[model samples]
Target: METRKSYFFVGVGGSGMMPLAMILAGRGDQVAGSDRALDSGALPAKFADLTAKSVALFPQDGSGISSADQIVVASAAVEATVPDIVAAEAVGAARLSRAELLSQLFNAGVLPIGVAGTSGKSTVTGMIGWILHACGRDPTVMNGAVMKNFVAPQAPFASALVGQGEAFVSEVDESDGSIALYHPKIAVLNNVSLDHKSLEELRALFGTFAGRAVTTVVNVGDAESAALAMSLPRDRLVTFAIDASADLRAENLLPEPFAIGFDLVKGGERHKVRLSVPGRHNVSNALAALGAVRAAGVPLAEAITAIAGFVGLKRRFELVGEAGGVAVIDDFGHNPDKIAATLETLHAFPGRLLVLFQPHGYGPLKVMRRELVAMFAERLAAGDVLVLPDPVYQGGTVNREVTSADIVAEIAATGAQAAHIADRAGAAAHLVALARPGDRIVVMGARDDTLSLLAGDMLGQLS
Candidate 1:
């Protein structure tokens, strides 16, 4: 009864774009895309997964944009000079930003849940999606990271789940100021911090996002989010916290190497929850998910039970393997807050951390270089080692003023063991060489999926 549409994604290999393509293709839409990564054959596995879904893939030289009826969806980062954009313009094809298309689909849902934050967006989105799916709600979930719980042979990259249900759960990005576009019935704000934008801009964007929702789930442990929660009507706010008292609270914390357990308290009821993922940060993430689903009419007890089954997202403190008493972990700790949380969680145990952090981009290094240096200087133990690689730049015209060497120099001045190796492979080799028995080698960064492969290679070398 519905007419199928055609969409051509410019950067189809992107974390955000890939999932949207999958969701569209799964829904019986004609989906095709082009990516520089595909043409270069960098991530063959990712492109193969797309092809397995019957989604056509092409090189980035504008060969995919065939007709005027096709909608060209691209991220804000796509410059007008891109071949896809040039082809689309020449063909008179309709164009939409990734956020515009996602919001268009999200806003049409009967019950839309938009999860927004500086960090933990993917984890919380995956949690809410898993809980709904486990509880048989059949939610349509869109995430930037692949959910381990949803991964199957056919759906190798199960970041987006297209379901025939009313509830649609998606993580809304605030980096490009697109969080304002989504109209969510239930909004979840995990925490507010300086990531892609300044605190002032983030505050205004996040405040309006939460205020528009019929019910809002907020983390009171974060000062900025707590302040925003106070500004919203109390009746519509559902608060969660680990250190601070709130409507949904996680107490009696227990941290382990591969898992964490805590007692979740809501009203007069309390229940123990154990997640396969490690860290106090994940406990906070779980509370946010519980609060969100609870606001969506899922019972507290049911949400807790379903959340306990959550494994976690790939690259979110994922342990690749343990060999010769050394563990290699892959994490998506790009920003200051995310890196701090990863450092804190890793520091909770007794092993020395050999952290190889690749900055996500030169632009972010310009913004948070000082904070990153400060976090590393404060968080790294006396014997711990930190290695830095030049940020990931995928052929873009960006200011390279703030290099990783500057960050390492600043951190070294604070008496921390820091080194900058312009090459990521050299950085990883350095970390591996510094790794000792009982030490955990963490490959941390974002915007690059090869970090996981690097972690695997480190594990292989260790073995």
Candidate 2:
């Protein structure tokens, strides 16, 4: 279906919803959105970032949904009791799931590329966006995280690029099973792992999404990704890997958080690419993007140039500030794999490490508590410290048994430094007081954007 000339978003401040609203508004749609946070007179700073664009924000009350002609779009979190939903229903406005509306735009374009996986979707989106822009293709990129490269004075991050070129790249979501909606011209599968959903559910959704594409780019290093790639039509699959044989493989890779750079060996050709981001996981993210770009018909040499100029995304290993000889790092690492990756990277540098991790949700911890404890115990050295705050979501219906204390106890059982702070403010203050000079303080979590802000506040205390 073609996009309507006007749109109304139900939760505009969301990481996923904000960029999408900006993209549609950039396409010249009459766009407005409402959020409960705005209605209750509490607006997070993240929402303020959208003020630079032409889009309008309203309270979650029916005020934002006045017209029947305009399409209503909502994220998975939006409920039927919302005033906008009620208004749309009363006025006979068409309510579209965020994925439905997003997939429509993606399919409408002449060139549609999807980056999907449990992790690295946002990073891959940034990588591919940079590659296309550097090749002078000027592709439109829609991502969950803010791309540092696209930041302007007014719009510090996030963009809805209505480029002259036909290519459009986006990171697809699977948390609510929305990944099924997208059918890309080129599909990139990073790695399949447990997070918000089960692997079986992830596999089916990602497999179906990739199979519908004209060309599917996949990671051969991962078993689930490799299995998904093998199921696709051979002619349609372009494989990439840091290991195993494939169309593109990253060889001689070295990740440094301080330098944020790596060297890649592709097809007997060795070229070092500098990434302004930390961790080995990001190197893998770059390879996934490179694979998708090649599958989309970009030349090998030009792909190198695009990535070299690419800066990292916001809140994913983001370096907020340094003061009092302490460097504060903010990352969206909530899952086992991501936590392990972050800890492993920081260990490479010569400094004591301290983690202020707020688990994203109670449900995710219940699913992966064992893995979480095991990974942290294995990676963290004797001097490293880990602080935990209660899981971020408290206002909803969920299993009550799972808590940060449970995960903390498990990690502590393995002889690692771990603590559970009942309050966010106390946790931030404790980290500041405990931090020694030259210690790397990393604030890690998901679902809540406040973690980044808290990291900044911690930096202020250290300063």
Best by lDDT: 1
Winning candidate number (TM-score): 1
User: What tens-digit string does per-residue lDDT give for candidate 2 at 1-463?
Assistant: 3444788888787777888888877776778888766666554555676655777888778887777888899875666776788999999998888889888888887889998988898889988998898888988889888888887777765645556687999999888898888888898888898887888888899899999999888888888999888788899888877755887776665666554565566667877777767777787888888878887789877887778788888887888989989999999888888888888888887999988998888888888877888888898888988999888772546785889998899899889999999898898899899998889999999877667779988999988
> What tens digits encode model 1's per-residue C-alpha lDDT throughout 1-463?
1338999999998999999999888889999999988888798999999999988998899889979999999998899999999999999999999999999989988999999999999999999999999988899999999999999998888999988877899999999999989999999999998878899999999999999999999999999999999999999999999956899899999999789999888878889899989898899899989888887778878888898899999999988999988999899999888988998988888899999999989998988977888888888889999999999998869999999999999999999999999988898888888778999998999999888889999999988
Off by over 4 Å in 2: 1-4, 40-49, 260-263
Whole-model lDDT per candidate: 0.91, 0.82
Query: Residue 148 in candidate 1 has what lDDT?
Result: 97
Q: What pairs collide in candidate 1?
A: none
The per-residue C-alpha lDDT of model 2 at residue 155 equals 71
